[model samples]
Target: MSERMTTATGTRDFLLPDLGEGLSEAEIVEWRVAVGDVVTVDQTVVEVETAKAVVDVPCPYAGRVVALHGAAGEVRPVGQPLITIASLEGGGDDPHATYREEERAGSGNVLIGYGTGHGGSGRRRRRPRLALAAEPTAATADPTPAATATPTTGGATGADGGARTAPLVISPIVRRLARERGLDLAALHGTGPGGVIRRADVEAASAAPAAKLAAVPDSPAAHVGLAPAADGDVVIPLTGIRKAIADKLSRSRREIPEVTIWVDVDATGLLATRAAINAATPDAPVSILALLARICLSGLRRYPQLNAHVDTEGQRIVQSAGVHLGIAAQTDRGLVVPVLRDAQQLTTRELAATLAETTAAARAGTLPPARLTGGTFTLNNYGVFGVDGSTPIINHPEAALLGVGRIVDKPWVVDGQLAVRKVTQLSLTFDHRVCDGGVAGGFLRHVADCVEQPALLVANV
Candidate 1:
């Protein structure tokens, strides 16, 4: 959901509302409504992809569509105008005047952080009423002139030579590029839809001087020492989730003094325990991951230091009051961590059900930004990838990550006799700054003890 701003005229500018987990920006995925369409409050107008999830952004104001900001694949910083709408009733002065009882089936607040608007069941379309009197300001617009989706255009209203408007730029990244290169955005004519400044526009501008320098012998461009792509090389520009993962992992590696400790645990008892529970209740089956999560929660209770964040600015370790367990699930886009809040408070059955729901949502790519962030610790089941072990990077600020490798039958010693048991490797990677090896080892061993002896869980109960 988004916030709205009032103008002297009937049109209101809808700022991209805060998609919480406190994300700063999101890329426009697609537009659900077009210009000339009528909308109700909480009606999803656009879908945006944050680093963590794809969220439906509902417009807070109920009105006729005037213009859309930013095209698909474009990233918009939070608080930037998302759309323009003209109120259909009440002279556009009061944004909520058009609300009807039937249109709102939901609690009126749907988007996790956007509390200003309620959800609507349907929207009615009418003949185009609002004129494209003003061209939607440039680069930030997210529609297409094409039929499939959003509006792509030239300028909207106030384009006359008499009135000066700020240059339209596609996204904050494009603006950042121009700033870093000291390229004046106003000087460049945007080639994107609606004459918005795009990244290419800035690159082309920056390359002009470099292009000239390249022609001169022994010029600075040649000595810049940048490598050129080979013929037939497929260059993939990092965007969206991949770029976010890179940034986070890069930050973690750069900031944390990390250490990984691992142990091979006999999971035969855990497997049998799962079978017994499922056999007793065939309708409600629990996953191994859920059990592992329960174990992690208990271990955190024993050693709270691992369930915490290092407040580097304050030089303090903030132990979380409750476990907000993050589960890493791989999707087509990338790895996403969907958090389960207050995980320690749930019973095994409750935890399993919620885990199933959360993981399913993650795989479907429908999790809201709020559900994707704010984890005290992360549990990664790299075992699904058929790997035996990994030195995983901690999910930044969080003190530790627990990784589970694939479970396989391996030879083992029990009661001084050779035996084959179901075994898995458990690895813990923690921030050394938070606690020493003793604390880390204690937590890891506690988790292993639970896995090796599922009956030990009764003690916690």
Candidate 2:
């Protein structure tokens, strides 16, 4: 998606390439290069936040920056002009032919499935969509009957597209915005280059409807979108991670017929096991989370059904060959599940190291996009928050999420005698379509068994 184009001039417009497949938009977190500064090919020019992680986008052209399109915190669609670079000296109108070999061959940067060629657009990029969105901000709120052009799917969603051949709509955010405002995309004229429909076009079409909503102030629908905030109400624009979390959770709840099952376990044994292992290797002491993660892998081995996701389109329950365990990390941005790939192949000590590494990276918001996705199963330790239990939502597409609650001293009857035991609650929320209560219960029970009796866990390992 990162394409650049040159005109019959000595300049190249570097468009923001597709950061990841299925991700259509990203917020400009920071810009590394300023106008007039020279930059090398593949040098990071800007950091963008796309749903899950912040990505550093590199400019593929070697030249001086001529123009910077957007600012920090601005959410822009992919393929838009990010930076305009004045090509290296003696460059003709066709920058690709005269530019360095890498410009024609590939970008040589890691941008998901891109960078192997497809660096420059090779043609003039469209007049940017952002400027259009800004120009008609006031003109879009008009209240005339002419205001309803809608951009519907076979086209965008939660991750900024993440469909309309049915039209000139490119950004899913534009499509969703059109749909929300009840505008017909076919009726509205696109002001963008080559007549592509931008978000501004949709907003312009919604002017009449917005004015109508203002007239009928009592309707619940009136308060949506650009509704005026009531006195004392704080408005937080839902974008970035918060919007992503909302869309994902809402979709998970709507599409997944999920169920929850829980059990109380004597976690005293689990703590003891960690203590003993720590005493032996104090320098590399295993964390409680790593122990739980090891046990989850064991449970997944025994009940693979819970480790699979439902391909709703194919109506198939596909089980993964290897475990890409997602650790539900609570970060300043929001809850992001940083994945530990091939967890099944790693030893408990290895898992401990990897888990610590990923969790820290997730918190710091430095993880690459690849490290933040493709999870088959998830382990959520809400226990860290000092909570006892939760019916956690299944991380969408993944069949189940295992929740571990606070381990506290609770009176229990061990060996038929009442005694205080360090106990914890374990819960599993799984996609029922993948497996019924039986598979879910088995996986949850296996985890609890490992927590209560580490001997079973040790034996398996």
User: Which candidate gets the maximum lDDT versus the true structure?
Assistant: 1
Q: Model 2 reaches what TM-score against the true structure?
A: 0.72
Candidate 1 lDDT tens digits, 1-461: 44455667768888887766657998886677788877766566776877776666766566789899987667899989989998686544554465534334532545654554354445432211111233222222222212112333434234255444556653544554565565656667688766777677878887886533213233332212123379855444566788899999999999999999999999999999999999999898988998999999989999999999998899898999999999999875678888999999998888899999998777655566778889999999999999999999999879999999999999999989999999999999999999999999999999999999998877875
lDDT per residue (tens digit) for residues 334-367 in model 2: 8999999999999999999999989977775667
Whole-model lDDT, candidate 2? Answer: 0.74
The C-alpha stretches of model 2 lying farther than 4 A from their native spots are: 4-6, 88-99, 105-107, 111-229
Q: What TM-score fits each model? A: 0.70, 0.72
On the 0 to 100 scale, the lDDT of residue 89 in model 2 is 73
